[model samples]
Target: MSTVTVTARGVTPDDVRAVARGTARVVVDDDARDAMATSRAIVDRIEADGRPVYGVSTGFGALANTQIAPERRSELQHALIRSHAAGVGAPMPREVVRAMLLLRVRSLALGRSGVRPEVAQSLVDLLNADITPWVPEHGSLGASGDLAPLAHCALVLMGEGWVRSPSGSRTDGGQALAAAGLKPLALAAKEGLALINGTDGMLGMLLLALHDAAHLFTMADVTTALAIEAMLGSDRPFQPELHAIRPHPGQALAAANVHRLLQGSAVMDSHRDDALHAVQDAYSMRCAAQVAGAARDTRDFAAQIAERELRAVVDNPVVLPDGRVESTGNFHGAPLGFAADFLAIAAAEVGAIAERRVDRLLDVTRSRGLPPFLSPDAGVNSGLMIAQYTAAGIVAENRRLASPASVDSLPTSGMQEDHVSMGWAAAVKLRRVLDNLTSILAVELLAGVRGLQLRAPLVPSPAGQAAIAAVGGTPGPDVYLAPAMEHARAVVTSPELRTQIENAVGPLS
Candidate 1:
């Protein structure tokens, strides 16, 4: 198993993925422990002095002005977790829950959240033990630090919620902790609030999305190249000189990738100087780089925002190095919200364009000289006709999902959080959009490869042949289209196939 050492310094996206999706153990190092101890000392001072710290001494949100007696302060913290653990909807994916746990530990380990070393260590134990709390999907407004979702996690730490054990058995949190030889955490002043007060949930989803988008966008470039060849489209548009004049970094990279993939292609060579071919290919074939590149640029922008968030201390009443606890609005998730929404829009456009290419590959009028739907017998067998319909349906769904969730908000916590970021919604919807985009690209690959097979006597480039082998599917009378489509999707997502393609064409951007 891989190991990720947590320190006061924030973690990278790869660190999050390792612990979330891979068998990685987590260790909170001494620097983080020391930082947490120093911050805990400040919290102790505030509690000993009985100062009216917002989260330390008083009620929360609209009740901040109300003071609690010292004897009931611990009760206050426990009650905060119980009340805020009111998330609804189905349980989140284990990977998402794990990511949330890891990011929460990262925030607390930074020591600004005023959590004790043990508090952060408890989360580390959960990650290392593979104990994932049952966090629900629909609770965060993307403001107030993913309150409900994080509270569910906090509830697990207190041994009061549900969790999936290392053996994948669903059990009570206390039982799971005891079985792992770990004890439930006792509430301390500001500890519960600290545990639940960060943008960890949404940020985790954003990081995971960014990671997957990197692969999906690269595959988009590969599929675009295949579609260009299958449709007998000109590769001149991908020339570096044409892209150089425009000079968008993503556009140049995308153009270069397609250009490399299509090198030495007999299909492109056959149509290179043929006046019999159409004067210009359709926009979907000719402008593939521009659309996919724009999405790549957008994905990069979202990544920049996620990287900054990874290093941020996103909590209320953060402990300052100057020996003071100050309340701030750093927990607002507008940055992540805007970035997630923007990336969804970009991904949707990529899927939309790919769907167009799929349609073209199935259309006899547009697919150069390929048969209708690439079927051996046009009317006797409907080859990939309905495949285009699937792509179209997903594209339409993606269009609706592309509507920005960040722009919508509702007041929560007695209007204390009057303007919510709705970033959690944006992140969730972005996941769906990416899933839809993957399927759409798979359909395009399915059709594009079949179209290439139909042009058998005129072979494709070496890279194209490698991709066809990677996404293997019989191009004859449509037998069972569903399984073939699923196989194509599996191939699209397989890292091994991506590696094989790179071996043939050099690395894609």
Candidate 2:
């Protein structure tokens, strides 16, 4: 029921999350309205003078040289929306649609897009009323402002497309608007181009993906702590004195978390002097900080890029305060594309390392004293043996998904828009990669928790105990593995593990 008053500045990732979840209403501030009015005057001047403005008076893209009379200008705007709303395949997730709407509104509210204040207000109204457009999954080239996907969203503004109700049921946009006590907006000069010409689609997904990544990175630390306890690995390698010599901030942070999580672990204490074991643990067990730390640093870099994008004005032919409308290449998505691709590479490596830990925990030879596959009777129960396989499968898939989509450019729009960024494709795949990483972490938690269970009377640290409790008790012989894995996945993906551990220990980095 609460609302977020959006200004020309100060929108954050958290704001996007709240609005996308339908828990917050958006209202434009007076300053943004004033700014928008200023831009609208410029557009009005261009319209009256019949100036050869890029989107205001002439056709778009390859047809830019063509001019139209004042009478058909309205038709030009309508035709532009109809033609560009060419997205196909399954409708995008409702949250993504909502985010697209919000970001588009934000971009226009920057007052550079030359739209009437009412046009932005209508989008805010649709969001407040919970009428989300049914945007499709494909059609953007990540250049020309996420054209096709955003066009689908703009279609609903004019009441010419479909939308989803608050209950997530599909309905006609016209019907939804009528029921919500609203009317369809008629497009004016430069409004159609204003709606579709931005990087909102790719940027919105990256914002959500970054939000999820923040939690996943913390979970990575929690699960890594559990893996170390289960493997009876030494924490000596994580010493602050050692990390200070070759300080990567992320590595040092990850090491500090491991040290804190294993502070008073009796399991680690029990093996501290066990000369029977090797002097050092395997790389997956000891080098978790190094690997996961590198991933964290890469994610931080991506977050920096997302923050910059949040502050940018992404439209083309932006209206200037000096009363000139000029075309520019701000619509190209190269920055977002590179960030998404780089983050995917980081996510894939984190999953790959976590899967290796799972394999080590389940292998009898590698696991030291644990029973084969961590099953009470290895022969009778497959006992998460195939869980490791599933993790491996997803990890391999992530490797393929991590192949940067941004590098593969194709020509479009009569080759007028060549060498596109493919940023939208990169962002879409990054989301999938993050999802796979969650599952991979869950698989590791499943086996790692069981390993700790077998460790028995020798208890883990408070943090490790919290993670073990979150994953629940180890399974008995020959039970259904899928449900247990799913439960573990739910625990791992949720904040339960982190909350319990943070409450027990001071807090994790």
Per-model TM values vs. the true structure: 0.98, 0.98
Q: Where does candidate 2 clash, by residue pair?
A: none
> Model 2 Cα displacement at 419 (Å)?
1.7
Please write out the lDDT profile of model 2 over residues 1-509, one tens digit for every residue: 77877798737888898998658989999998988999999999888877799989889998888997888888999999999999887878888888888998899999998999999999999898888898878999887979999888888889888887657677898888888998999999899999999999999999999888878877887778788888888889888888888788888988888888888889989978888867888888788888878888988999999899889998988999998999999999999999999999998998998999899888888888888888888787878889999999999999999999999999988878877999999999999999999999899888878888899888888987887777776657877789988998898788877888889997887
Candidate 2, residue 439: Cα displacement in angstroms equals: 0.6
Candidate 1, which segments miss by more than 4 Å at Cα?
Answer: 165-170
Overall local distance difference test of candidate 1: 0.89
lDDT of 1 at 5: 89
lDDT of each: 0.89, 0.88
RMSD of each: 1.2, 1.2
lDDT of 2 at 6: 76
Model 1 over residues 1-509: C-alpha lDDT tens digits?
78998889978899999998999999999999999999999999988888889999899999999999999988999999999999888788899999999999999989898888999988988888778998878889987879999999988889889886556556798888888898889989899999888889889999999988989988888889889899998888999999999988899998998898889889989987887988888999889899988988999999999999999999998999988999999999999999999999999999999999999988888888899999988898999999999999999999999999999989988888799999999999999999998899899888888888888888898767977887776578669889888988987887776788788778888
